[model samples]
Target: MPKVVLLFTGKRKSGKDYVVSKLKEMLKPEDCSIIRLSAPLKKQYSIEHNLDYDRLLDSSPYKEAHRLQMIQWGERKRESDPGYFCRLATEEEDKPVWLVSDCRRLSDVEYFKSHCSTGPAHPSCVLVRVSASDEVRRSRGWGWVGGVDDGPSECALDEVSCDYHVINNGIDEQLDMKLKELKNFIEYNNNG
Candidate 1:
């Protein structure tokens, strides 16, 4: 069967992990497997930077500043490699449905475009974006107080351009509804 990957993104504490976990539960063991790409980068970075993994994960720089470091390192490791995230996603060929959490940039989108197979005849790819107000995001544990257009400053301006947008305003029930909608959307569009 062709694979279906749900590419999700949001600012830190925008409930990206929570939403992805919800989808994992909804999809179940047989329906899909949830794969997180940032884990590998987090681990490697923790080791190199001498920072606690859990502590660094919640840091805004972890996604922005460290992501650049990771990309540069990955480029040296392999000249066309899109970094550890894409590499990991490609390794998960056995799963029919994949929930790809934490997509961050246009490069990440293009990496998925090149790595994922999508068509009317195949399972396809679904890109869903999650967002929240700066207040809500900060309240939910977003590391940085100010949003930035680039680099490690918590909020990135381009997140609105993702394929599907979900506003996570810190309400669990609302988040659930949006995720359910996403699940239905994917099934409906990829059923062929």
Candidate 2:
């Protein structure tokens, strides 16, 4: 178990990765590392579809072209095992602080709450909701897809409880303040 598990959820292109990237720069390497719940999904999907996993992980046309299908495939996988990707993402992490960068559904949050938070290490698990305007997301390359934008994967945690609510609009004053608040949470929770 980690000293803190910072679980983050946000809509597509809401700057979830960007916020965590900023956190990575703020925190020392030995103190924190990012874990993406989508990494395992993309790895498996690439194998099944004979696609390059590297390309799938990149921000290229190939990834955008298959984003919807990959989302559907991941949904099916989650239906069978809600914690599959969540487990894969964290099982190997030994850092004292884990920034889980892509928590989409409520189950993702629940998984950490049930497993990591209760271990002998007594990890501090907390939800963080990252938000940005739809216009900002569109500008960041997230065009609306009828089924996915309407689906459970995107909407499951829209109203869920969170310890921090951050508005990431390109690292403005508001974002800096919110990030400091989050750092306070981590600084309080970190083991050393």
Candidate 3:
């Protein structure tokens, strides 16, 4: 069973990956594992589309070029199975703390919520949104794609409420403080 689950959702180049990496470093010796939901989806998408999985996984011009097409393909798969990638990502996760680092839709969070938490009153799963400004993301090499930036896969959880909203512009003191508190939260809940 998942002792503590953090469902993370964010836009492209929103420091979601970077923040999760920090969480991994901070959750030390506590059996924390980061699950990128897109990994399995991208692998399947790459196989079916005859694309290079390695290239698709990287943050390169190659990935940006194929982002729209992949989003379309992913939407088709998600329509058929919303929880497909979620389940695949967590299949081998044996750790007590799970950080789902790339949740793109409401369904993704809902899937983990159902699987991780026993009841609503004593919820074990936490939804976290890591966001960086468009200017900041652009500085970090993020350019908007038409279909992908505007589509359901990327925009589905934008308006939803999250337990924690982290603004990761430059890992300033405020962001560091929040992360510290989050680490404490995870450790307390994971071993309590």
Q: In TM-score terms, which candidate is top?
A: 3
Give a tens-digit lDDT track for model 1, residues 93-175: 56667787777655566666666756546537767877789798778654553224344323432544665788888777878
Model 1 weakest lDDT span, ten residues long: 145-154
Each model's lDDT comes to 0.65, 0.86, 0.87
Residue 20 alpha-carbon offset, candidate 3, angstroms: 0.5
Across 57-141, the per-residue lDDT of candidate 3 in tens digits comes to 8899998888888888888888999898888888988998898889988889889988898676666899999999899999999
- By TM-score, highest first, what's the ranking? 3, 2, 1
Between candidates 1 and 2, name the one with more favorable lDDT: 2
In TM-score terms, candidate 3 sits at 0.96
Counting clashing residue pairs in each candidate, in order, gives 0, 0, 0
TM-score of each: 0.73, 0.92, 0.96
lDDT by residue for model 2 over 1-192, one digit each (tens)?
Answer: 788889999898899998998877878788898999889999999999999999988777798789889989998998999999998887788998899998988889888888768554544888899999988998888888887887877898988988789998676889888888888878877944
Ranked by lDDT, the better of candidates 2 and 3 is 3
Between candidates 1 and 3, name the one with more favorable lDDT.
3
